[model samples]
Target chain A: MRTRSVVAYKGPSGASVEIVKQTFSSARPKPARRVSFLAGLHGDELEGVYLCFLLVQYLRRLKETEPGAFLGEVNVYPAVNPQALCHGSRLWPFFSVDMNRLMGEPAGNSLPAGACRELLADLKGCSDLAVDLHSSNQHLAELPQIRIVKDFEKKLLPLALQCNVDVIWVHPMAGVFESTLGYNLNRAKVPTLVMELGICLRIHRDFCSQILDGAIHLLHHAGVLNSSRRPRGEIKMPLVLKADQVGLVQAKRAGLFAGRVKLGDRVGKGDKIGDVVDPVRGETLEEVVSPFKGTIFTLRELPLIYEGAPLVRVALDGPDER
Target chain B: MGEAVSLYKNVWEKGHFVDTLSIVAGLHGDHLNGLHLVSLLSRFLQDVEDGRLPGFRIAGKIQLFPMVNIQAVMEGERLWSFDNLDLDLAFPGSSCGELADRLCNVLYKHTADSNYALLLDASEKRCVSIPHIQLLQPDRSLRRAARYLAGEIPGGGPDRFPGLGIVRELQPTPAFQLRLYNQWIENNVCALVLAGGRSAGIDPETNGALLANVVNFMLAVGVLAHATRKAEKGEARFYSLENERRVSASHPGLFLPEARVGESLRQGRKLGELRDIYSGETLEELFAPQDGLLLTLRDYPLVYQNETVATLLVEKERRWYWPFS
Candidate 1:
């Protein structure tokens, strides 16, 4: 195992943002393939960072205990935006730029600019498969999910299935996806899968363990590891939920939102999902109801909400059940 | 039935095809001055609507949004409850973005057609400031109208509210007022921001003075059919944001202020002192950068490094009658 640091950018304070790459190689390597794992693109999303750290630890232990057990190489970029991570901000603190949108753009001297170039350069001609992990906003708690571009679903689904996530969401090759690092890497002939789970600024231990085990299993599937140990959890087919039927519950009036249902709770149509109460008067102003009978996938963790702000997101039941 | 209802919607409306003035307040929940000012204006307009004021027909419609950040108002906080975002900072917001974005988008759409927009705000808790108006890129007519209104309001003195109007070149951030200025500029709307009051409680006299200024502004802009007072003549001191002075803490500790709001200070005057909270040792002394009027003073005892302790309105070379010593 070896560690290297690639200088991403020089901050205004003269501090350089160096993306640390920790690589574990197989002893029996003879022109072996390489798979990359990246996390913390959004500074505040640290679940993937913790998961990558654990994965690196696991791979390092495996490499030391039994040499020649793996086939190729595993590269991990644990925290990409150091400046943002410092302030627990989702966007780069100085310029307030979103790193995800800087892919394929000119690398300026601003926040995330040099970092993007360094990352793209590292992925070029050096990686075979890539996994980009992220988390929802701080107010949102999401189920462990894998998102794949629509065009790459056929080629990436089997690999995504190994991750043991709760859902597999396929997004079209349009909008913000075109500028994402996963999409950029995919266009570079490297298949990349995006994984999202839990909340920002906080680590979900169970999800981290699940993703770590999934990464190990993915390595085995990619012929990197020859171990017989499979992914720990049962390989259940994640629900292939569509984007249209996802009911978004928004606030009708500004108030303190108190959700009646917790994450992963199954609710029927017209059920009271939550209540928006006036913070000053202590009176319930609005009662939010579930539009479709389904499981609550992402609920607002924060209590404050305004009119038109989404308070809950429910994964709807399929047409057959509806 | 003791049921609660949200009836404050569309509080005041009059006239059609005439110029519209959109007034919004409570972007931060603890900013009570603007909320009180608009509340009084709404009641006054409601009286007109009920025919209580005979032969007084408003030429234009007034849209009064009393509290934009309702959750913040209820919680008695500065930022919105969801994500703790400052509503003022979220402007020209995204439709599919977070809570603050959506709220800003909604507000923008509501006031998109107004000919004039006013943002009323107050100083944060643990701080106090003299009432002032901030104008961004004001033209000759807007400047004249603003000055006309400023002359009518009786501030704590001749140089308090309506007395200090600053013309800012641009906002440093993508603030709500900046966005409104941009939107209004595109549609030829005059946008102005009036900041006043303290964090603790509402001052009715200040609200009344502000209300008179608004009424006078409406008359000056041909929004009101009748003028109540004679045209008073006085100059409203205008300065650029670049000329303002800010004193920040060099050390984090309990802050003891030496000057009061609206007080004048010469160069080398001590502003405040930062001391160790537990040890009670003096950490650092803050001093004035120039001879200026103290517009804002830090009220909170505990302060962190780099936090603003006071803001001074630097004196200009061109001076008018001196009212305060």
Candidate 2:
């Protein structure tokens, strides 16, 4: 096990922040391939951080029991935005800038920009495959899923299928995704999978363990783990959905939202999903309904919602629907 | 019924209205300085149209968009409170997209025919800046127009346009590509951003200065005619990206700034001090690294470690063939 500081910056007083990466490599002179696991890009999203922790723990045990089983290398960057993670905020505290949106740009003395550049430089050319894990924000709980841009869909879908996620959504490209780490890495010809699971600031143990199993399976598939030490598990095939196959339910009035449908629950069209009620007036402002016969993959966890806030996201039923 | 994002353009037209000058403000709802400045301009233009101002007249066409992000302004937020999306970053926008996107598209289309555009912008939230013109990824023609507006050209005298003597040229970052200023420039409109004051509020002094700057820009661009004063020739100080220095806090604590924006300072001058948040003990004193003008000062007292507290615009030194030069 080797830990290295990829980037360090001095604070105004004297304190320093460093982004560190831990690597576990095999004893063989030349291993099969290297895999990189990254989490905590947004400080608030902690599920991925716990998943990385689980992987680290499992790898440590494997190295202790049979060191030769670690065939290639596994690099874990558990916390990419250390300051944000420390502050428990979604953006870097200093600049309030999203580090994920600053990738592939010139590092021009700004702390967040420089940190992103340094992290990208460190990750590039260091691994054969990479997984950038994230979680939904405080408002919504997302099912374990992999979102791939249509541009990189062909390259990422096969690898995403190995991750045991509930869905593999291939969406069209937007300008906002251009600066993302996943987009930049894929553009550089290094295939990267972006896994989003659960909600921010909370850990779902079952979800973490499920993804951990898939990650280990991926390590073996990538030749990072020896065949003899391959983990046995059934990898679930994910429902592949296009951008238009998803239905979004938004609040029509500002009020308290009471969600009736749970995540992963299948519902028919016009099903009562939730209601926005004005407590002061003792009136139901709006009753939200499923737009199509589909499975609810994302549901709003927080009750207080604005008029246009998204309440639920459903994977619509179709020929491709499982 | 869906609420529409409506835009109101106050236009003043006169003889030979071939050249059009567009002035925009309130792209971010919280940035009140620009909104006030543009409102003042609108009133001034109305006065000119009414023949109230004896010496000033509308020579060409001038369009004033006093409140671009009306919804945000109404909500007292920097972005649209509904979606928290920045209208400024959704330029060349989608007509069929969200409210922000549709608003941006309408604004872009309305301003497409402008020969010159000036955006009155407030500085970032929790920060105040001296009134200055910012040119992002400026081409040769745009630079020439900015120089003219700043009174840097040979015909326009220096100090003629008070509060706009400083011109900063910046290289647009990747995220800047979506900004309205960048999009306008790409479409051949000579556009510049005048940033000052702070967000969510208005400062009379900063707004007054920005108003004068915009009026002068209109005058320079031949959109407004002045019969009394003759144009004088002088220089406008120009700074590149390297000239700006950002000073950040070393520790998370209460930041008390001793220096104000637009103040001239010598090397090693005290800029601010940082104290512990809980104990209130003085942790560090920030000092200027060189002789320059303090362009921006953080207005917020509570700052996290490594957050920028101030930015200084260092004066450029002329060099000769000598070794020191």
* Reference-based TM-score, model 1: 0.61
> Which residue pairs in candidate 2 collide?
A11-B250, A12-B249, A12-B250, A13-B250, B30-B200, B157-B232, B157-B233, B157-B234, B158-B234
- Worst 10 contiguous positions by lDDT, candidate 2 chain A: A8-17
Considering the two chains of model 2, state its CAPRI-style docking category.
incorrect
In candidate 2, stretches whose alpha carbon ends up further than 4 angstroms from where it belongs are A10-13, A227-229, A249-257, A276-287, A303-308, A319-322, B1-22, B28-32, B49-51, B55-115, B124-128, B152-163, B197-203, B220-239, B242-325
For each candidate in turn, give its C-alpha RMSD to the true structure in angstroms.
9.2, 5.5
Candidate 1 lDDT over A219-310, as tens digits, reads 88788787645445665567776566567778877778888898789988889988989877879998888877888878888776656677
Q: Candidate 1: what's its TM-score on chain B?
A: 0.83
Superposition error at A296 for model 2 (Å): 2.8
Highest-scoring model, DockQ: 2
lDDT of 1 at B174: 17
- Listed for each candidate, the true contacts retained, as a fraction, are 0.07, 0.11
Candidate that scores best on TM-score: 2
